[model samples]
Target chain A: MKLWVSPRAPSPRRVLMFIAEKGIGDVELASVEIGRGEHRSAAYLARSPLGKVPVLELPDGRALGETRAICSYLEGRHPEPNLMGIGFEEHAFIEAADRRVEFYLLGTIANWIRHGHPGLAPLEQPQFPDFSAAQGRKLREVAGWLDGELQRQDWVAGKRFTIADITAFCALEFARGLMKFRPADEGFEALQAWRDRIAARPSAKAGA
Target chain B: MKLWVSPRAPSPRRVLMFIAEKGIGDVELASVEIGRGEHRSAAYLARSPLGKVPVLELPDGRALGETRAICSYLEGRHPEPNLMGIGFEEHAFIEAADRRVEFYLLGTIANWIRHGHPGLAPLEQPQFPDFSAAQGRKLREVAGWLDGELQRQDWVAGKRFTIADITAFCALEFARGLMKFRPADEGFEALQAWRDRIAARPSAKAGA
Candidate 1:
């Protein structure tokens, strides 16, 4: 199997970290330069119509796109180090938390980065005219919510290290380059500690 | 298991359709009124800190929020009529298509409706001052993309009926309230037929 990825993209990093954590070694990486618009090339488009990075091409030539979907596939294919959870209730809890991180946290962060960062404005297009103010407000709101949630749990999905933590950690770390973390924010102690723990993971460092 | 849902909300309707499709019984429905802002109530907040509707409260009192996650849980527990897919590859295909519909198509439609429709402005902060133009552009872009995709395949994720179809169909139908379908749009013949077929399903009608 070959994984088409971009070095700097958050979505691709999510998959790479999963690969590392799962200790999957039969995969090859084909890097695409997003800055050069390599993802939009005809070759890449055949693999992913959306022109997004992190497209996984199977041995049979079938290609799968989307980070979470790829991660889900990996978890299913390699069930020993279960990232999705084992039973019905656990599955529900992990998925619920994962969706929350994606829809609420990561979605907000993406909107912020797309609308706020000067470099990304052209990519996001006409919906976001003045990206700075809109992006800033969204970032602050998302961070506040995430900090609160982290304070109440040992991990993003509760006591276990699940895909929710992966999603949140990737987004939070990505946001650091664009938005400053408020160290003095209330209920962020646990979040800070959690961040350090996640960062120390061998998969995260290797993936980065 | 009890499903906490709200009438007139498309997210909850997705869950309703999943339940009906799977022939899963013994699941009770608990209504939460979004119009009255009951989703933000203290009790509901405890169930879902995000305070969103369509939360599935397990028999053990633990609640699962997010429509996709709840549907996923249902699909996992009752795997006979699988809404996700069969095996690893099929699962990835369905999930990839599902996420595409959610992030690109559904995201655009919901943004258009929430920001464009005067009725939904209060639900989320009305950031986009010019509602109509933004929403109109978003609708056109999303519908055109969907029409193109539907023209090529029997179902969203290939030959089989999956959650991708459910998500896309729900989003398209929900958008009908705001945007009219252009029958004249090129390559939409298959989409029109597919829409009708999905509408004929007992689950769709029941959910509606």
Candidate 2:
């Protein structure tokens, strides 16, 4: 199976981080240049209807989009040292936590960049500074909330390191690059520490 | 196990439709009054940090939020009729299709409602009319894309009926109530027919 990804993308980094965590090195890689509008080409659209990066091409020639779905699929095939979850209940909670980070933290950052960043002006039809600023405020608010949550638990979904952590790490990293968001200065002591711990992982740098 | 949901919610309705399809009647039901802000109570917040409904409370006191997660968890435990998928490869594609509906069609509709609907004024602080209007246009654009996809297939995710159908059904139903969007009137003949077919299922009404 070949993985279609853009090195600069956040979503593709998610899949890469997961693969690095699993210590899997055999998967082939095919880069899609997002900067040149390669992802919007007809060839890329055939693989991903949304024409987005980070698609996994199955051996059967079927392409799979969405980072979570592809990660879960990999988890299903490679069950050992499980990163998603262990059983039904664990999977449910982990997914819930993952979605929480996604909908609140990651979603806010994404909206900010898509609508606020000048570099992406060509991508978003009509950029809205007001809307982008609103999302930025949401980012700060959600970050504060996450700081409190991290004050209580070690990981986003309790003890073990999971996909939830990976998501937050990548999202926060993206925020750092796009919005100049610094967790420590934002009064997110716990979250800042968690970020450092997650960043120290070999996969974190390997994927980058 | 107990299911906490609001009758009028779109996400909760997705889980309900899935339960209806699975013919699972033994699950206990608990209603959260979102209009009255029952979901924001201390008790509910303890279960769900986001203070949203449609959480599946496990017997062990674990509460699972996110409709897809709960539905997938249930599918993991039940594994009959194979609504999610039959195997690893199938599961990946079904998930890919599900996320596509979620990120594009459903996400746009939800944003338009949350940001534009006056009934939700209490929920979304300082709503932006311009942004909301932008999302509304996106709703129309994505609906048109879906109409084209449905023109060639019997179901949302290719030929087989899956959870993707339930998600789109609930999402479009929400739009119908909120926006009065009639697929037939808008030249979405294929999508209109698909909606009717999904609505005819016994499970569609059972959970609703």
Candidate 3:
């Protein structure tokens, strides 16, 4: 499989980090230059209709897009050190946690950065600062909520450092890079501590 | 298990339709009135921190939030009518399809409605018409893309009517109800036909 990636983007980085965590060795990496509009090219769009990055092209030439979907494929292929969960019940809870962080935190950060940052003006046309400001507030609210969760548990999902942590960490790191956001600055001590801990992992350094 | 739902909302309706599709009868229903702010009540918030509807409370009293996660749990329990998929590759592709429609279509429609509709002012503070307009444009783009897909295939994902169809159908239905969107009116014949097919299903009437 060839994984088409744009390392700079948070979504692609999530899949790359997941691969690093699993120590998957079979897949090959092919970079797509977003600045050059490579992802929008006909060839690339054939693989990913939406022109998104981190598309896993299978051996038969079929491609699987979406970060979570790609990660799910990897988890199914390489089951060791499982980041999702074991049983049906565990899977539901873990997925619920992952979706929570993905939708509320990462998604909010994406909206804020896309609308607030001038650098993203080309990608997100006619940026709206007021809308971005609303998302920014929502992001901080979710970050604080996450901090409360971390205060009670060791991982974002629950007892284990599951895929939920990878999602939340990637979201936080994206904000750190583009929005210059830090949970510590906002008095979210537990969330900041959790971020520090995750940053120390080898997988966190993947494609950085 | 008890499924907490607010049928008036799209997210909860997704789960409701899933239940009808699976023919699962063991799960009980408990309604939460969103208009009455019951979803924001302390008890509901404890079940779902995000306070979203359609939370599946397990027999042990543990709650599983997130529509997809709840559906996954139900799928695992009742695998006969397999809405997800059987194996890893299929799971990845199906999920990829599901996510595409979800993030691009449903999510965009949500942004447009929440920010543009005056009735949603209480839920989405400080509405941004410009941002909502952008999302409306994005929604049309995605809808056209989906119409193209349906032109080539029988279902949203592929040959089968998987969970992807469920998501796409729900998204289109929501747009139809809220935004007065009609794919046929825009010359998206394939998409309109597919929507009609799904609308004819008994599951489509599970909530509405």
Q: List-wise, what DockQ does each model earn?
A: 0.63, 0.69, 0.89
**Candidate 2 accuracy as lDDT:** 0.86
User: Per the 3 Å backbone cut-off, how many clashing residue pairs does candidate 3 have?
Assistant: 0
| Residue pair clashes in candidate 1 | A115-A131
**Model 3 alpha-carbon miss at residue B140, Å:** 0.9
Candidate 3 residues lying further than 4 Å off, grouped into runs, are none
Which run of 10 residues does model 2 chain A get worst, by summed lDDT?
A199-208
Worst 10 residues of 3 chain A by lDDT: A118-127
Candidate 1 structure quality by residue, lDDT tens digits, A1-208: 8999887677898898888888999889999987778987998989998787799998898899999889888887788688888876687788888888887767777777766677775456654644335655666666667778778878888887888888888887777766664434544666778888888999886446
RMSD of 2: 1.7
True interface contacts retained by model 2: 0.69
- Residue runs of model 1 more than 4 Å from their true location after superposition: A127-135, A182-187, B129-139, B181-187
Candidate 1, B1-208: lDDT as tens digits: 9998887677888888888888999799889878788988998889877778888888888788889889878887888788888887788889999999888877877877776677776675744746335656756665666667878878888888888888888887777756554434544676778888898899996457
How would the candidate models be sorted by TM-score, starting from the highest? Answer: 3, 2, 1
Q: Report residue B51 deviation for candidate 1 (angstroms).
A: 1.0
Off by over 4 Å in 2: B206-208
lDDT of 2 by residue, B153-192 (tens): 8888887999999999888888888888778988889999
lDDT of 2 at A5: 89
On a 0 to 1 DockQ scale, where is model 1? 0.63
